[model samples]
Target: MGHINNKYYLGFEGEPEIIFTVVQKNNEKSEISIWSGYFNNIMQQITPVEGKWTALAYYYNLNIGWYDESPWLVDNIEDAYKQFKSIDKYKLDDLEEEILEEILELFKKSIEENNNVYISYE
Candidate 1:
């Protein structure tokens, strides 16, 4: 029998976060765990799959562009802190929540439309 391969999404609310896990069967007796990561943006996670592996992504809506804005665009932790110090506090609070809800709705729609093609790991 072929080894079971599967993918799962951990969170679907609040912020745009995703976890991707790939399991490959190395032999008839065991399986190996492969790549995994969390993406905060929709564009960053969009890519084509290659070889004998498949890809899966799960994300919320609020965090779509949260990290791409200024102050958060620093190269490292120290730079981020320094930039944050000079940023206007109220400017960060103006982000719209409705947009997040719309994005989440779109994600759900895509998943539902593609449900028939997915193989359940559980």
Candidate 2:
């Protein structure tokens, strides 16, 4: 099965603050973790997605004079951090809450350092 993957850049090709990840057979970093969700209804609804993502990228492409390549700009990454931080603690299991906290740490570091978080399905 295909899995969603993310990579962060410090505006350079260095190690990123990875929020979600898994390992592969060759000891390489790969994606595919089935235990990613726990059944809190709100958790199911939680994701760091911008609603007008496609439109934003489309306009960005036009501004760059490129019709074929539309890449989402990293300027809006604060929205992603806010989503992760918006989880209601009362509804989550202790483990789920802990996981979210851990993930938020990565977001915090990246944001503070002004890095770019990249998500793709590989």
Candidate 3:
């Protein structure tokens, strides 16, 4: 009953996928999950973290992450491809490369800054 939102899946290699939703003010469904090993690894490396990741806007707040809808919101593989093509010129392969680069850098930065990494649904 609201505006439709695009789903963004974020993850590191060899680990399970972690989803971060790109919410449209009025839109939304889907189940969201982060791997336990991934979560624990991050916590251990970051240590005694407080604030943001403290259950505020973090993924732990499941109330905002799920619904009875498709994860990609595409009804079928064919439709998914068509919709993806309509959105941008960049191929999914290109996007994957870019996302990986950025994510790797983010992980490095978190380690360097000793700051908690907060991947929130937005």
Candidate 4:
């Protein structure tokens, strides 16, 4: 009934790189196609996300005000990029091109590593 009705985790080795959880919606739908469409759109840049998970925003929120030589610990090359970019940042909108690439790479790597990109509906 609604556009987005489920949660999806694009991850590798049991760790989620992209957590597309339903933050808001009008109704519920049992099908996962809706979410699949959303994922496809994000990958293709087909539509602006209204209220889905945002990888850049998450990095910003989780890294703001962090201290140390490096604010966050990174697990991979892409994550290192994200963590370094998120350092000393405050804005939520206007994601940088490099950060977007890292986010995209997260999913892409999941596929490259033979990891399932979708999690069960939430």
Candidate 5:
């Protein structure tokens, strides 16, 4: 018999803040290469049901097809939020106004720099 092994930790927002890695077991043992810190602090602590947030990653890889179509990509914390709102149409009212403003500011900077930022849902 084989089993799937996974481990994660909770963040201040009470969500799975980190996904350590996924391991599969079989007769022929093998390990999958997972990049740690793939989704660190990328997501805001907003509930999908009430806060207009969606459980989706907001950032797309430029290296991937179709994403390259958009020359300007959000590559920072703030811009990522904007992109999230654009797609989800949810407001971060539950969060402090100062935090929201800071995120927005970071997003603007990322947009200006043409950086690609992404967020994962809890």
Candidate 6:
């Protein structure tokens, strides 16, 4: 059988409860989705319109969609936040915006608690 990557990752917020992503953690399961191709397609479309984010690698660092069964594991959550704070939310479609918001939220909690929240998929 050929290998198929069934799972991809999205980061989320801190609840001291979830085994979250490498860059961050979570409050709900729905917050952590497995979208192997969705981010590539959606982000590609959204990036150009949002120009501020089109070139930032750390922004992509928040979305580990390209890495199957691996976590992002960022060393500095605050730096990520500073770089990402300017992302224009209105440019994104509802779901995409929601995902960005969750990523930011997770970054905040991780920064506050000084802990790393990482996730992986099967």
Return the TM-score for each candidate structure. Answer: 0.20, 0.44, 0.27, 0.23, 0.30, 0.50
TM-score of 4: 0.23
Tell me the lDDT of model 1 at 95: 26
lDDT of each: 0.26, 0.42, 0.33, 0.33, 0.33, 0.47
Off by over 4 Å in 2: 1-34, 38-42, 45-75, 120-122
Clashes of each: 0, 0, 2, 0, 6, 8
Measured over all alpha carbons after superposition, the RMSD of each candidate to the real structure, in angstroms, is 18.0, 12.0, 15.5, 16.2, 14.0, 10.1
lDDT of 5 by residue, 93-121 (tens): 32233333444553554456544433222
* Tens-digit lDDT track of model 4 for 1-122: 43442233332224423332121223232222222333333433422237542443343334331122222322233432343344432322233333444345544554355333222322
Candidate 2 lDDT by residue in tens digits, 44-66: 43543464333223333244312
Would you list the clashing residue pairs of candidate 5? 74-117, 75-115, 75-116, 75-117, 78-107, 79-107
lDDT of 1 at 26: 36
Residue 85: error of model 1 in Å?
29
What clash pairs does model 3 have?
3-27, 23-122
Runs off by more than 4 Å, candidate 4:
1-44, 47-99, 119-122
Stretch of 10 with least lDDT, candidate 4: 65-74
Q: Give the candidate number with the greatest lDDT.
A: 6
Superior candidate under lDDT, 4 versus 6: 6
List candidate 3 segments past 4 Å from native. Answer: 1-92
Model 4 clash pairs are none
